[model samples]
Target chain A: MKIGIIGATGKSGSKIVTEALNRGHQVTALVRNKDKATKLFGGTVTIIAKDAFDITKQDLTNLDVVIDAFSVPLGKHLAYQHIDLAVHLVHLLRETETPRLVFILGAGSLQTDDGLLLDQLKKIPDSQAWIDTPESQTHELDFLRTVTNVNWVGVSPAASFVDGPKTDYALGKDHVLYDANQKSEVSTGTMAVAILDELENPSVHQARFTIRNK
Target chain B: MKIGIIGATGKSGSKIVTEALNRGHQVTALVRNKDKATKLFGGTVTIIAKDAFDITKQDLTNLDVVIDAFSVPLGKHLAYQHIDLAVHLVHLLRETETPRLVFILGAGSLQTDDGLLLDQLKKIPDSQAWIDTPESQTHELDFLRTVTNVNWVGVSPAASFVDGPKTDYALGKDHVLYDANQKSEVSTGTMAVAILDELENPSVHQARFTIRNK
Candidate 1:
């Protein structure tokens, strides 16, 4: 399948690109920095260097799937870009089912005993600096829920998302999943595998699913 | 004040353009049809012919206020454009305080004795034909509420938005308002006056207000 990954040079995005290529699927890295993408992928993947906001329908028409792994740096005041980019992409893809969109969301949107994980994050000391990232992503999921005509799905990581290799994973809908050891976390590799598995098999639609290392 | 009105050729939008012109403010008709706008206002208002989605921030930077009076016709399958266009305008104006945005929303988002007016609208027989308009507008308001950095406000007319001249009007926040004789309606003229008054006085901020004939 032809796959386009926005923010393909980012942490989780690079892993997804590698996983997709290893599976023999064609990959297109949609990034703002062509030099960085070429350096990272080393001519293994096609690169379209354009800001996410400037990506047009013509650029996405040939792809079977598009993964939105776009992120703003934590502690920056530009976290609202998460929600803005999501809305831009969704608006461009309205009334179509092809080129399925997969949004990589944050764990803050997951359900917890004390309501949303975002509610707890707000209580942490000095969370104001980075809280907007999760809050904007939470709003992104909420906006996606109202959309019915678009073929889109959201994925949320567990409380701790870190860089690591693949592992056996557990999946839950809307909730914060805990492993047997009472840890709620997922690695970049596990997330990539779970996302590719879901894309190939196609289970969830217009809703969010969470993953944790099991 | 210089003001821009999207959909200035439409029913309520035309009235707004007239009211703004009457108040001696320079009005620009940011419309899709230049001929139609020219036929409506002739040389009275400057016209920028472009799709609402294609409207850019550069075109809006000079205006003191931009009224989003864009609408899709009833019973059309393109009702989702309401939410899409709202998101587009808000995204363009993010992180800015200039060019206050006034969104002309639907009453379906207003609260009623039974949950929301949208819930009641959904129960009407054969409403499927026109329900998408209200449903999408409701979602538009939901999306706007999450935006914090933009200087935006929403105005919803009463249950029966009709074509007539301006009259005595009363305002309420969030809830559906009714007139003394139990009619829930507002003339396009009243809506225009109320909107112009609000734009001039700047009473509401980052919230929605409803109006009815009193």
Candidate 2:
């Protein structure tokens, strides 16, 4: 299958690229920093150097799935790009079914017994600086929910997303996922594997799903 | 004030362009069809030919206000362009306060005595074929209300938005506006006048307002 990974040099993106390549799918790293992307992939991947918002449909043509693994560190002034980029990509794909989009969103939009996870995060210590990304991402999913003409799905990692290796994954929907001991976590490798698995075998449609390392 | 009107050849836009000109404000008509727009304005208005979705900040740089009066005939195909174009324009002005945007929205998003006006519109016979435009525009407003950084203000005409000459106008917020006769209606001329008044006076900010023929 043909695939494009936006922000493919980032943590989750690099893992997804590796997982996709290991499964023999052709991967194109759609990125802005060609030097960093080339260094990260060691010239093993195809590259398209352009800002995500500037990416045109012609650049997206011939792909089966476009994984939006784009991310910025939390608290960045430009955190709103998370929502802006999602809307830009959706606008490009309107009224089309090909090149299914997979968005990597945060858990803020997920519903818990209390309410939205975003509400809970706001109450945490020093969440102000980092909460904008989650708020913007939650808004991204909200915007995506209103769009039906495009083929799109969103994936959210567990509450404690970390940089680590893959594990057997547990998939859930619209809630904070937890293990028996109430531990909620998902490593980048586990997220990549679960995402690749979903891309290979389509399950959910026009909705988001959550994954946890099990 | 220097104002730019998207869809300046359309019913509402043409009127707004004329109103802005009559009020002594410089106006630019950002439109798709150059010939039609030139025929409409007769060389009185400056014209920038391009699809609304393709409009860039460079084209809008010097404008003090951008009136997004772009609309499709009720029930037209590709109605989702309403939301897509709004998203595109907002993305262009993200994190900036300049170029205060004025969106001409449908009354479907307004509140009714029972619930959202869109709920009532959905029950109308054969609404499926034409409801997409209002639905998308309502979603457009929803998306805009979520934005905080951009200087955006939306205006929804009354329940019965018709094309006619200007009359005494009354402005309200959120709810569908009605006159003493219990008639909820607004002419394109009235809408244009109210918009120009708002642009010159800067009444509303980051929220939506409604207008009706009084």
Candidate 3:
């Protein structure tokens, strides 16, 4: 499978590229800087040097999947670039034979007992920069659902994600997964594994899934 | 005014220190690490070392105001610590002459259009991690309202915050603040200004305020 990653130089995207390559999949890294891409990801994967929104119009439909591991840095433009890229990718995917689109979403859109989009992020402290992304991502997800015949999966990480080993964590649907004490935690590696595995299994088709370590 | 700040090492706490000092208020930084206390913030500010939970027994009742900037890294722990710390702070504040106990809360407690707590966050694309802290911050806000005499103010940040300059943001009551286009963004500096201003003015006393950049 030839996969195109939108933010391949980011922390999460770099891992996604590594995992995709380890699985023997042909990977294309879409990034703004080739030097940073070379420094961060080495030479194992092919690189696409373009802004997230301005990729050369190729037949992206022939690709197996497009994983948006792209993350806008803390002080960059709000979810502006992210939404633009996702919408463009959706349009590009519509032209391709690719059957699935997987996005690495933040955990902000989950519901509490009150059933409101948890837009008021207070619990997962380290990822406060993500607080704004969910509101825009929610808009993007809403847009994606309106499009017909494009299968999409939004994979949100747990409340706390540390850069660590792959723990092969469990997955939860609709509800935020909590441990025995009802705490939610996951590693970035395990989250990448879950998304990639779902790409192969299709259990979480057209739905959002959360990953957490017990 | 002599002010004591718990969680002085956190984003909110550091701001409290800066704001209080900038306003010519005598400030004390209550932290867990003495070395980081000297490095991150300098020595002119008095540094008191203690666990967040242990502050209840400290002689904080004499200070003009006690701001529990102390927050568990939402990504590191669920809202358990936040709830526990708030509950304890409320009880301790009741014993002191200080009339106000300001809490930096998560946006999960804010009421949505449906009049429910926006606790579910996984549905949102980028904020999955905040489900824990925001949910817990909501609980703390509710608990603060039940107490008498000790005025509590819960300050929830808008969608995204970064190391940006203070842009003179606006304040919303019980609802999330939005820009002209309804998108929410706030600089940490402006959030600090709003919070410290609230501390002096006492508007929205015994309630919560959501802040976003203009």
Against the true structure, whose DockQ is highest?
1
> Predicted chain A of model 2: TM-score relative to the true chain A?
0.98
Error of 2 at A102 (Å): 0.3
TM-score of the second chain, each candidate in turn, equals: 0.99, 0.98, 0.89
Task: List the lowest-lDDT window of 10 residues for candidate 2 chain B.
Answer: B72-81
- For each candidate, report its DockQ versus the true two-chain complex: 0.73, 0.69, 0.01
Model 2 Cα lDDT, one tens digit per residue, A1-214: 9999998999889999999999999999999999998888876789999999899999887899999999998898777888889988888888899899999999899888899999999999999989999998999999899889899999999998999999998999999999999999999999999998999999999999999989
Worst 10 residues of 1 chain A by lDDT: A75-84
lDDT digits (tens) for residues A1-214 of candidate 3: 7887878878788788878888888888878899998887787877779866565347355567888887776544345445445655665554344646887877666655656345446455764565546655654554444444456788877766678768758888766777888777888788778777887677866678889975
Candidate 3 residue lDDT tens string, B30-140? 789988888977866888888775674455866777777777666654355675577556655553446467788776776667564464454677665656666666656
Candidate 3 stretches with Cα past 4 Å from truth are: A1-214, B95-99, B114-117, B125-130
For candidate 1, report its TM-score.
0.99
Residue A176 shift from truth in candidate 3, angstroms: 32
Give me the displacement of residue A23 in model 3, in angstroms. 62
What is the DockQ ranking, best to worst? Answer: 1, 2, 3
| Residue range A72-179, candidate 1, lDDT tens digits | 899888888998899889888999998999999999999999899999999999999899999999999988998898899999999999999999999999999998
Better of 1 and 2 by lDDT: 1
Error of 1 at B175 (Å): 0.6
